[model samples]
Target: MRLNDCLTPAATAIRRKAASSRELRSNLRASWGDGVAFGGMVGFGETYLAAFVLAAGLGELTAGLVGSVPLIAGGVMQMVSPLLIRRLHSHKRWVVLCALVQAAVFAPLGYAAWQGSISAPAVLILATLYWASGLATGPAWNTWIGTLVPPGVRPRFFALRTRASQAAVFLAFLAGGITLQLAGGGPHLMTAYAALFAIAGGCRLVSAWYLYRHTEPSPMPASMRNISWRELLGQLRSGNGGRLLLYLVAVQAAVQVSGPYFTPFMFRKLELNYGEYVALIGVAYLAKVIALPWWGSMAHKVGAQRLLWIGGAGIAPVAAAWMVSGNLAWLLTVQVLSGVAWAAYELAFFLLFFEAIAPEERTSMLTLYNLINTAAWVAGALGGGAILFLTDASHAGYLIVFAASSFFRALALLLLARLPAIEAEGEEIGLRTLSVRPNAASLDAPVLPSLPSQAE
Candidate 1:
């Protein structure tokens, strides 16, 4: 009787494990497809919003404002996301709602374009509501996914997810860009814009449906525990997580200083068509796809903080590289460099961040972190706008902003030294099993000798 009883429980446990594995696989496949559609939507829509404003005869400063104002409002929305999520009692629900609203916002944009009323101010108003709704979905989705993915599998999963998404973005950008050029070859370019936006809306609607179908592992409670402002401030001053957030903020701000104006510079000054613009971005995305696996493998061996340093240092020169040339080959080379650098940073940033937080704290901390990040990005865009205003949109003015961005990026790299070289959720990092360095070949010996903990 005792043997039978033990066997029954053991057999039941095996069955349950099998069932869970099946579910995880199902969710992962769904999520992968979701990523594909979402990536396509971003390429078709998000990447072109500023450019569309420029094409609509809004000029450069208005383009900057269209990107900035909506984003700032969205950042403000993030502040309330935690409270709203608590009241709603479901992260997935919040994500679905927001995603749908973001999708719906684009419908009007398409109509506005068709109606010939898509002015800069109109874009700002519509985009704010669009971006705010969209931005609020981010932290919620991150937190919800945190619960879905097993901790042991996060690095590989995230890296793969990123690679897949980047690949999709590249392909979609090619198709969308070609579509735009062909459409604009017609009698009315506004019709082309409208068609592009309609496709984007459909892509987003599919993403929302995927969001709805993803299995919610558990219902988030109505209330979450949060640390006091005083406590959070202390951590920001001294803790690893806080410092990491600071580093991300600094880097994003530096990037945005010139990021928003790149399209304007390319379109107005370089005289690139939509196809050429998409090609530049596509090259970058391709580089990331090629580089992701190597970066992912290195993550387990060298640690995310160290990789962050390498990425930051690599990225610092890329924006400034723009000022050196307008040659297509040179710009393509810059885009490739930019993509490789950002892949390392993006992969490490997320893994380390999730590692630092306890599961219980993810909802609040992620939301707050995103809130601050959005604000920093908006501030950087505003700073760039100010510079453009002062320069009166001269070629020299654009160059000055680009140069300032590089300087700030280099400044941001200084923060990496302050971060600890630890695994996402483990002890201080040291010489570990080194993976094959991308450029180095084995000479029947280890490429990297186990050394003292710090590379420096």
Candidate 2:
């Protein structure tokens, strides 16, 4: 009794907090599994796919198409997500099944590579299936996670989750680069790709397992309003929300104009070894890991819109910077700068997209927005491919394409400049203060959305 009486209230408080912490962990346990699963995907995606395709004897056009065609197909595939959700009664079910399919898509590829069956067209077709499965999962999964996390913890939780995923991606990318280089580029390289992709698929299956465990708020909340096509079209025409969506499409179109070609340029033209290529790409991911929070802070200080402008304008010069030098050190510097700008632009875009759309409507809007965004990426890829083709895939051609990409990015910034800034009450929005969702009443936010199109 004497010892208890002597004890500080702070000690009791600490005990209480510890108990609550365990309860919190129980509630969010599924999300933890999901995070681990997503980390696995970092090992292989579009970037690695580019390396694989090129090593398979495909040309620049094939590399560009690797990113482009899948996105184009995925966008079209996503249009059906809402319908699937309607039939399934649970977003988790849809996500889990489709994700398993995505993983399985890799299995056949391994067999094909071993059989000498891998080719540009075969890769494109298989990749299309791979992307279709994953992309379809996104709409359902984003909607599901949005309902899972409470807002008070969303900012920090999402940031931490994203950092973890990015870290995994960085490590995975380093591993892939090493595997490709050590394995050496030749006919045998296809076997290596098959094995790596198979492993990557297994990772996704793990993610699916975690997703299956996640606790989702009832898939259909009470009295929810379903947005119709006419309303969606109207938003595109005069709504502030539509403008935000268009801003993204514009920015991405600008970025992709030269984005997909970087692989071909470096690996084929500059002849950077797999390690060097990985270094260039991996640095950007690392920068993202380090800089995302900084960007979030800047967004807090200045405002998401202002940072977006800075990011938008800042991003425009990055592709052009490559034109100034082919030196690895110089290119590495360019990647670091690009990573910072990417953090700013990407964070701002995520926040802006969520802020402008309503909660119950996110599933529908995101599905549509992603579809359009995917289409824009394809357009950008096609534009880059055309430039390279016209120039005979020459180094000069790449420079010209890079220069054009810069112009388009600047033009996209101008569009952003015309848009209105997001207003906040009592406090400026930072990653800490924000959840990147629609109205919490029924909104969905993608804390760790699979940002596949971003780097690759």
Candidate 3:
């Protein structure tokens, strides 16, 4: 029978009766395999490239800018994506096009860096292109992901995928670190960095190809009215969404303000060697891989709101731990805890945000979220740079600033307590209530109608 014909009731029933118990496992393996390939390439490539670039005499501010520029550019692009989606009329095509652009941009960046004499203006422009390319892919990719991964089992599936990705990331970091060591910390390092970027770009191309292979079910019909910035603002101002928006803004501001400087601080203040630094970071990523499943389960059980608090409460101590990290051991301990806490925060936040928004509004909602979060990151990065400049990069001063930022994050958690619980599949759920299945149609499922041109 044809593939479509095989999906009929009689065929399904027959398959169910004949199917071995291993079928489910086999399907899961396929999903996770794809996830791993995609995650490994993107995650490792991004981190390895950043570390390599920083080692090539990019000042701390410049290094931080490299990291933040993509976010800043991506955020700005996201603001207009909803409209673009309407005008373009094809999320998949747009995503593929963006991926191609990303590949094109990076090849030149690598070549320029390898040749040396890359001007600051050129670097900034390339960075902007790179960032924009990545950012443009977001809405389409995210929407496509929602279609591919069903809602009811998202937490479990994501947990499995994250573990696979994290494992790859761990190995990638190790290899990248070794490569940097072999290349040494000078012009040759730039060569290695450029090579890594080339490899990364290749991997991204493969990922894009894989994405194109997958089927995206039809989207919900577009709403009659097009979406506008005014409408978006109104949505934020009028409902429970408004309060959540405020809380998100607060959290983003707090985290981003101090987060970007952590690496530079370690390098400058602690004087960690390249291998040692990457290894330390590897420990954190490893911890995250180990802890993600548990956090995913926890988010499924307890509501994301409560998990948010746990994550927030945990951050203060982790930040505090940094102050006393005079050695690798202390830093490793802090890294483990920070990784676990961040996993919880990330999984919970995404789940919560997905649950809170209606299907029709997902793209716009994500766009807004990205925009706000990006702005916060930019503000924080700029602020951190200013602080460092003013203090002449004093370790003590940076530590104090980071500690304060952690406290501010905790305050945002306190604000989360007052936010309403999100209802999933007609049930009011808490962080501890993991058994409740979310709405399949709502969770990343592609059945929902798209917003009209005006709505977009």
Candidate 4:
């Protein structure tokens, strides 16, 4: 059956199920609200912290390194997180633990910065703690989400959540930028930024608390004794999994290579003031919010792989636009495009990832996926820095880096083309021959209706 035809009954079923379940409805609303709040506070803290680091006599390379190092460390650590989760047998508890750790770390980092001891090493250490928190939380978070959010409703639900989150991020950026502007880039400004971080940390704590309150249906453990490195490697070599891995790695490498430099490029090369920088990012995020729902719907309609291609194809020109123009107006325009592209890429990627794996394998697959993505980001940052150093920070250096990255992303898109499209969870209409695990009673209500026993 055609993909769209298969999806009709599933969509109808989901609407019916949603109308029937008051409890599920309430949980969905809460999750959406919490997600928005968490995203906003974090985005605010990140922008302010980054600007503060730049203002404190750190160079572009150092600032970029600050962001990239944690990712690298997290990537390396992520390989073990799944094993830890398996041993612990509790994803939710680990996520809360990570959040608590983050809160503890942030409070001190902010206090120290307020006391005027913000050094490169100090920044790196704080970042390490932060990223470690991320490493611990990410796989578990994804795993939990997989269970909580049903597949049929994910597109619409995520679209709403992302829209709200982006809106929050927009406000946070504006607030942070305004605070910095009022403080006049002096030692006092550090206190304001530090306070922002503290508040952001508190917000995360609240989010963690809310998450703990969420009821997750328990998952069946993998029958295997342990997930070995060899087993992971074997999975990576199998079927569409291998191809998807390569595509993800390549896309991550491409973006990360040039991604870390974006803020630095604005600060160093363009000499954007704090307010302008915040405004730029805020607008970009807003653009992303506006574009996300469309992308989500498109993914449901067409397929994720095609959307990936669109995202991959768009990056190069967007990067090249920055190289060519270097004007704020033009830069903002490109950032808007980049935001749309990123939204499409992210939404489609997550949906496709969930579709790709079995429920039993999700934790391991998610951990491995995050590990590779983090590793790619680190490598990209380091590689970009190396290229910049070699070329003595020339404009040509950035152009060369972005160009190469874009080319590789395009290559990844081409690779993605070879993989078969997975059916959307509810959308399987006439294919009764292929077997699927029905949702158990303990599982959330089936969002999509079962397909007809036989195709017409």
What lDDT score belongs to each candidate, Candidate 1 first?
0.70, 0.69, 0.60, 0.63
Query: Once all C-alphas are superposed, what RMSD does model 2 give against the true structure?
Result: 7.6
Model 2 per-residue lDDT tens digits across residues 327-426: 9899888888887777677677766665655566666676677688778878887888898999999999999988998888888776776777675211
Clashing pairs for predicted structure model 2, backbone only: 359-443
lDDT of 3 by residue, 193-278 (tens): 77767776776677567656655454423432245768877877776677777776787667665666666766777777778777
lDDT of 4 by residue, 1-456 (tens): 765566678797886677657656766776666666566556656555555677777767777677665766666667766667667778777777777877677787678668765788888888887768756666566556556665667655654565565556557667767877888767787787777778778767777777776666654333323456678778768756777777777777766677667777777877878777776776666665566557766876777767766766775466556667767787777778877776666555555555655555655665677677778767777887888888876778878877776676676777777777655322221000000000000000111111111111
Question: Tens digits of per-residue lDDT for model 1 on 307-415?
Answer: 7777888888887888999999999988888878876776566567656555555556656665677687788888988999998988999898889888998998778
Which structure is stronger by lDDT: 3 or 4?
Answer: 4
TM-score top scorer: 2
- Evaluate model 4: give its lDDT: 0.63
- Model 3 weakest lDDT span, ten residues long: 433-442
- Candidate 2, residue 182: the lDDT equals 87
When 1 and 4 are scored with TM-score, the better candidate is: 1
Worst 10 residues of 1 by lDDT: 441-450
Ranking by TM-score: 2, 1, 4, 3
What is the TM-score of each predicted model, taking all chains together?
0.83, 0.86, 0.79, 0.80
Clashes of each: 0, 1, 24, 2
Better structure of 2 and 3 per lDDT: 2
Give candidate 2 regions above 4 Å deviation.
1-27, 186-188, 424-445, 448-456
